[model samples]
Target: MPDAARPSPNCQSSHNAADPILVPGRTCWRMEKADRVAVIIDAAAYFARIKAAILNARHTVMLIGWDFDTRIKLEPDDPMPGVPNELGDFLSWIVRVRPELTINVLKWDLAILKMPFRGGTPLVLLDWISSRRLRFRLDSAHPPGACHHQKIAIIDDALAFCGGIDMTTDRWDTPDHRDGDPRRVRPNGEAYGPFHDVTTAVDGAAARALGELARERWHRATGEMLIPPPPVPAFWPDDLEPDFRDLPVAIARTDPMADHEGTQKTGKRGVREIEALYLAAIAAARDFIYLESQYFASQKIVGAIIDRLSEPDGPEVVVINPERTPAWVEEESMGSARSLLLQRLHETVANPRFRILAPVTEGGEGIYVHAKVLVVDDRLLRVGSSNINNRSQGLDTECDLAIECAPGERPEVCRSIRSVRTRLMAEHLGVSVEEVERTEEATGSLTATVDRLIRPAGRSLRPLEPQPLTETERRLVEERLLDPDRPEPMAATILRGATVFGDVNRTAWRIGAGVAAAAVVGVGLALLARRNGLGKKMQGE
Candidate 1:
């Protein structure tokens, strides 16, 4: 058997600062075991793998997400033939054919209320309710401003995927992230921007852990106890190649400390497991840390990075982020915050060891980097839904899976980690993995390796140039709505971040946001009322 298939060799964990093994409760929620693990790079690969996994499910499939769109195609271009390709049709068709199979879907309640605007039809959603076996629930289990943000799918408790990719529209793009790919079109006939994301697939114990998490969430939202389906003998997807086998994969979570009214829930210490892991991983780095995330507005994380960079022999830090934020308020908040953080990181670090970049297609079109991944010193690999934003660190409910090759041991695993990082770099650079490997060997620095592979044209990663924020934007940064340290109400956050925005009259912009927040609550309540009415009408029928 190949070295990748062997059990990861264990190294004695030390609490010593100089050499610490990430511990349970300190750096993570639980250090569970996995029979095999594979890191899927993009949604194009992930969606197909999910389709296959669901097809192979013998008993149950559970999907938990921030949003769910029934229209997205599981296998868009070359769909699975015998059954329909759309996610709803495919799932329902399979269950119809195999009556014993059942699928449970849970999505954030507010997100569900907005689904109609995104092109979901009532008839189709009604189809979901038509099947008693297809249990669908909208989750409203969190404090104000907090979201049930985990994206997870567990099949028969044997295979599971956890990461940033939502099984929804505008999420299926290839590594190339081309601007004009026909498969990138939405159900509404308009093409969306190219997207980039990732997820980790694990079998056996790791899958069971995620399944357990999903069930706990189900109980919290709907008061239904979900039972784990009997384990299946074998169900790994055929196309995927495992990156590591029989590895100890750690699962971590973030649950809001407050209740619906934003008041602190007594005795509920906020789950900061993911945050602890972030700091520990940054502290553990010996050479480099490569990160790709959707948002980067967490001050605590930035402080940790600065601390590491302050070291005389600090490791290089390379970050990949989208050039422009997707939402306007996000730009006002995280975008502004990023500029401030970059400036501090640039001025405070001893040397120019910190670097950030945004990915662009070979045609020079920007491709969004929505993947949440971190690799440190060719030993630690983390892939999941946790972003570097404040909400992901502690406010919203989240799940992240991570694995590490122990310090001073497991050269094979070390090489594998390096290989995964190299491949990712190569994908962004539009070069072969061999080229990345050669560059790494020559330079021994991630920054230098990336600089070497940058081309004049075509797919490549470009340096992220921070933009100057206006005085108003800077004040908003202090308000922390976009980069709130905790999940709280928008109006309160905005008012506070103001010590913090009128670049239009910035006051007008601020007021507009406040009004919008009110409108959203008003909309949420209206929809909630409508949902209740629908429930009553259905009962009568």
Candidate 2:
């Protein structure tokens, strides 16, 4: 730790251009047939795609995520050509088979700390990098206290996957979320909830851009410049065909230090590009807006939705989230804040059309919602590492891809978009679309379906109401929010504090010394200024 007070060389430069200029309004950009796109509705699809991309990589593999679990199985039960079922085993195999190739992994440091009991696999990944030609490092150069939260993977720099899904364990689930699938297992064989997420695979300019992002993160984390891998033979896998064609796509990034540093600022002092994008999508909606996210807090976005609902012509909004927060302190604190935000939004929107829900498995095996997605007007779709929360806005850097379908296209395109949401519901209920429709049609809307699913002995996987907080819970929330080390301000003050303090103190002697030193210096400066003013006044008299 060489003067942690000094900013890392990898810190993003504010002097640089804010971001690649986005084309104004919606215009269809033609995509190559080979540059196909697919919307992975949940973790199952996301994992399958990852396995496929890995098997297809002919030269290099680059992975960047908010978190990466070594024990995760990229392909749960399904096997890929020349790959093992477990993620860690598969990576080892890949390195062994292709000694000449390079693999780079980057993840946020804070996310690693979130897993208190886990061993230092991240450090192990870094050590592996030193032993082999591969490169791995923990990214902490983000605004002090901010997290590098983008989840992306680039194979041979020819194909890439970007989305909210992470390459972590307990995220795997098939489109068929069976009632008692033996395949679904957690610590001590505990059953995990059905999860829904979305990721996009592309092989064109978008893919190249994602590769650029991975490379940038790698350089930032490791202080090593990575040369782009040589173009590999069979860059695009044969089986992976284009899901759609000639669709225009946009790649957006969030940095707090970017343009308009006021309302967009996050805890890390980075621009909240994700928040901006969500608001834009909400405003652009003409029909329905469907979204799936792990958490829904952020008053700014909730306020935006309420504003839209107040308008005479607003799009219907549907949200899917986990039935309850994870049984952890962080989840409990953040989840309560999110629930409050949702309640505020509910108060503003009168109609029953705007709904937020969680996916529940039949027989009351709690709904474990863990997807992040935003589909707007049935024309534009966005998926990536962002959760619908304040932290993702500016505090943590996020990358998301948006696809705009060409005008007057087939309903199948819209169906493809809707299928992601429907598929999640189908899996949870363990029922077909026809049966789901027959049972849910009378109820109408996802909320009604959730109500029906909650009925006694109902076989449907429904979205349940969030559990209410108790008096003790409220006190805990206040404690976490007021904690000096991790102040949960409505704005991006958390990032400011993290950055300003830096590494001023290290040893136990300087534990609280930094804060005291800052306060004393501030007071002395104020006193000196007042004394100088009085002296000047006396001289004038």
Candidate 3:
């Protein structure tokens, strides 16, 4: 394990040509400095800290998300009887123990409806709602098919957590990515393949910004305002060590051209800061761009990537995604988008640095790279709920956090960036950070480092082998059945219903989507069994 010592302070200045983070009205809500920030990798670390933060909450506990599951145990192995581990029960228990504490949970209305199918009972939601202290609201404040796709948890306006992981089922997993791990099973005892994800814990001003965002979302959805929590509770988690201290953090958001009532919020159409940031980050990459996302179905993002690759001295670009997109219907859409994008991207980039690969377990079962992260030249690190797809870019409401070190700010910032990238690669390769750092230094290349550490067994990055798409999939991609870049008109969504790579966050998983077998594949039955999945909170925040 790497040293838990807190990292040095992050850069403070603005207007740097190289770094795009903390730029007001461009990349973030505002350039607020966090008293402390810890980038927790994987669900185990993320979830455990959440539990600790909630337990430590005093006045307010606000959870804003696309999906929520009550059946999930906050800390399954390390139970806290005082709070009770199960989510719904835990919230209830917290309110009971602390009479002054009020819990506010705002989940997407449709996602709340899909709770039962994901192994959660309606009674659980009912219980939380019935408890006056535990306020629950199902948010339905978007155009049809548009999602409230932000995954955020703010406790007492002091501590906040935001990233890919949701407080739902099937999200917990370690870096080992072991084959058939018993702990990776669902509530029904069915084991899921290895899962990979991340979230950032923050305190001080940054936490307040997240709290403000959550409260604003709640007001937009429910038309009820929540007074900012009093400065009563403590900031930061006691158990987890801070990775970066007193660093300026940017909170970037993406909203469709619609308002809370599905009307135009801005005259221009929609907020596309997420998209602009992607373009900026890609353009600014001096050495390499490493990205991991749930879907690769955005043509505009691909176009931007292709632009970078076309440069005569373009940096290496490596993409990490799932080996398979899960649902056959989803495969027909997102899978095809990936293959087609890869096909197009390959034609533009002549270097082997432009590679798309999947992380696999010891037995080669794909470790779903649901983490939406982008590392540009190891100087800019973005972690959030925005994926490489168009929906996340503009259709759905998204929030991402970015950290960019002003070029020459601190030697430690560069070291920290390299450390973060190496840590991520080491997790996927099942090796220590020392090995990855040494190998990467020796090879003088991220791709070559991964190549040398790449293994045929255990955890490793495998080249994503694009499969032959069925006729149905090809047609779906052609028709834009799933990957819509902008929020479609409600009329279109109501008349021509379709789907894309939605939420597989929290503890929930997306196995399949509503498939038109007869029309698409000539099959009689719908291959997709469940619809508990919500569009993802991309991990790049």
lDDT of 1 by residue, 1-541 (tens): 1111111132111123346445777677677788788989999999999998888988999999988788888777788768788887787788888889989888776675556576555567666655578767667767666778899999999999999999888898888777699989888888999898999899888798888888877766666677779868967888899998876888877777533222346556677778888878877787888999987777777777776677767789999999988877778778877887776666666357877989899789889998999999887888889888777887788889988888766677778888888888988889999999988889988988888888878899888876887767666555555545565665675565443332457554675577467558845764674475322223422
lDDT of every model, 2 decimals? 0.77, 0.59, 0.72
- Which runs in model 1 stand beyond 4 Å of their true positions? 1-20, 257-266, 488-504, 507-515, 522-541
RMSD of each: 6.7, 13.0, 9.2
Q: Please list all clashing residue pairs in model 1, or write none if there are none.
A: 362-458, 362-459, 472-501, 475-500, 476-500, 478-497, 479-496, 479-497, 502-506
Model 1 is weakest, by summed lDDT over 10 consecutive residues, at 4-13
What TM-score does each of the candidates earn? 0.90, 0.74, 0.86
TM-score result, candidate 3: 0.86
How far out, in Å, is residue 49 in model 2?
3.3
> Tens-digit lDDT track for model 2 on 1-541?
0111122233222211222222322111122232567666567667777776786676778988878877666655766666677666677677778777677777665554444454555455544545444555555555544567788899887788888788886677766555677667753356666555667787766676667667766655555567887766535545555566545567666644333321222334444456667766666665567777777665456666666665565667777777667655445556765555555555545656677765555555655666677877556677777776666765667777776554555666666655555655565555676655666567655556645554455444443344566544443333333121222333454443444335453431242344345445534543443343311122321
Give the best candidate by lDDT: 1
